[model samples]
Target: MTLETEFERVSMPLENPFTISRGTQTDAENVIVRVTDEGGMTGVGGAAPSPHYGETAETVEAVLPDLLTAVEEIGDPHALHAIEAELSTVVTDNPAARCAVSIAVHDLAAKRLGVPLHRLWGLDPSAAPATSFTVGLDETERVREKAADAVEAGYSILKLKLGTDRDRELVEAVREAAPDARLRVDANEAWTAREAVRKSEWLAELDVEFVEQPVPAEDPEGLRFAYERSALPIAADESCVTLSDIPAIADRCDIANLKLMKTGGLLEARRMIAAARAHGLEVMCGCMIESNASIAAAAQLAPLLDYADLDGSLLLADDPYDGIPMLDGEIQLGAQAQAGTGARPKSVE
Candidate 1:
């Protein structure tokens, strides 16, 4: 059956000003894609652009019209890889836009089979690991407050944004606020090799799980130097973008942080998980600050992950779609008998 496609740009407001190594954002700029088959089964997807990855809302939106046209030309929602190949030829470098199309196709395939995405992939929902809610860079008091609030809300794990010189104080405050919660930190490529090793030692003392992307993406040698002596496990975020980038940094990191927008789609993401595992690196399925559309698509692959950082939707003040349901920090997907990614578009009322 021929597939019909459409897209819309959405700006999802953040609950708080989200700060990372790159800067801050008060809203998540996203693009939503909807696909409907001749049989009337519908599938949806979303993309959250990050300037760090060289994609913005304008870039994503600029590529969507041609992307939609390409999807219509392809005509078959089940041919995900084929659609992906066609999309690559249609547009280059817009991974977020590519991700939106890839996700919509996967969603349509699962919907056509009358099963949730995890079920279609032969995955177990119960085995899906708990996700970590993020606490962005904020004032020490606000950071402590946010940590306490997350713990009080029943979340067992918290991922904190770190990079500034106040990193030590911020982590210490949160540790004091939520003594029992498992903690992880993302440096967003803010540290130098020496600084990464030094910070990792300090972070390890506080029981931080792992340090993500300490050195900038441009410096592979720096990551290697830090990896040699880092007291905490180092996960590659900025340094690892696509499949090809994996082999280059495989020895430089202990973990691979896979995001749909980074890899361009669910199919490539699945490949990334397998590739990471093949190389003896643990897999972390992560996301940008996004709506439920992208989070839901990523959730379908959670069972394959060693760690999950899929808390993008949790940061949104209001989401345009409902997909994965996260309680505390755990993902609930056992009852998604509906087709697609099980995320339904919400009325903009």
Candidate 2:
């Protein structure tokens, strides 16, 4: 039976401009993939490309036609291992594309088994932790307003983007607005090791939960130095990409935030979570600015994580899919993910 595959490029406007140390995005360009088996069971997934990770929507689109053709030729959505290996050989370094294909296959497999992905993985959605909503880098007043708004909107955990010259001011502003909100920070590899140490100490004073990727990924020595000197726990984002990169930086950070786009798929992501924990690092499941398709895919792995920052869809002004519903930052799986990753087209009746 020949598998049928469909791909499309989508642009979703962000509710607000999201700024990080590396850059800013006012919109998200995603590639949505759907795989329909001979049984007419369709599983959907998406690729949210990150320029920081060397993938753009254009890059993802460029490689997907041939890649999807190869996947269709394989004709076995359930054999994800072979599919992933074949995909890597055809499309190199396009994790977003790989992630899209991988997730579509996983979704199909789960739907075929007539079980939710979490249950298929032998996990419980009820055990999943609440996800954190993010406050992007902005002026102090805007940061305060966003923080307060997020907190008031029922978000108990807030992750703030830092690493600017006014990092302290921004954190202070947010603290003033959402003092009781559990605050975490991501520097996006902008500061020097010494500077990271200083900022981490300052952030500790305000009760920050942890600092993510304070120093550059290229500088492992700097990461270790900052990790050793900082009073707060450190998490590695860019520094940790695929499974092989984990061991090299295992001891340098307290946590590893795994993004499906970075890992290339749910299989690799699950492996990454296990690998991070094996190295004694707490695991965080994260997402880029994506639709509910990929967020729903990542949410299926929520029961295995220590923290979750899967609110990328929440930041969007409009979403084209609905996989997992986030109610006030809480992951409301309910029965939505009962088939595949539980993400379905918003137009479905």
Per-candidate clashes, comma-separated: 0, 1
Report the CA-based lDDT of candidate 2 relative to the real structure: 0.90
Tell me each candidate's TM-score. 0.97, 0.97
Candidate lDDT (C-alpha), each? 0.90, 0.90
Worst 10 residues of 1 by lDDT: 334-343
- Which tens-of-lDDT digit does each residue in 17-77 have in candidate 1? 8988788899988989998999888788898998887899899989999988989988988
Query: After best superposition, candidate 2 residue 327: deviation in angstroms?
Result: 1.1
133 Cα displacement, candidate 2 (Å): 0.7
Off by over 4 Å in 2: none
In terms of lDDT, the poorest run of 10 residues in model 2 is 330-339
Candidate 1, which segments miss by more than 4 Å at Cα? 347-349
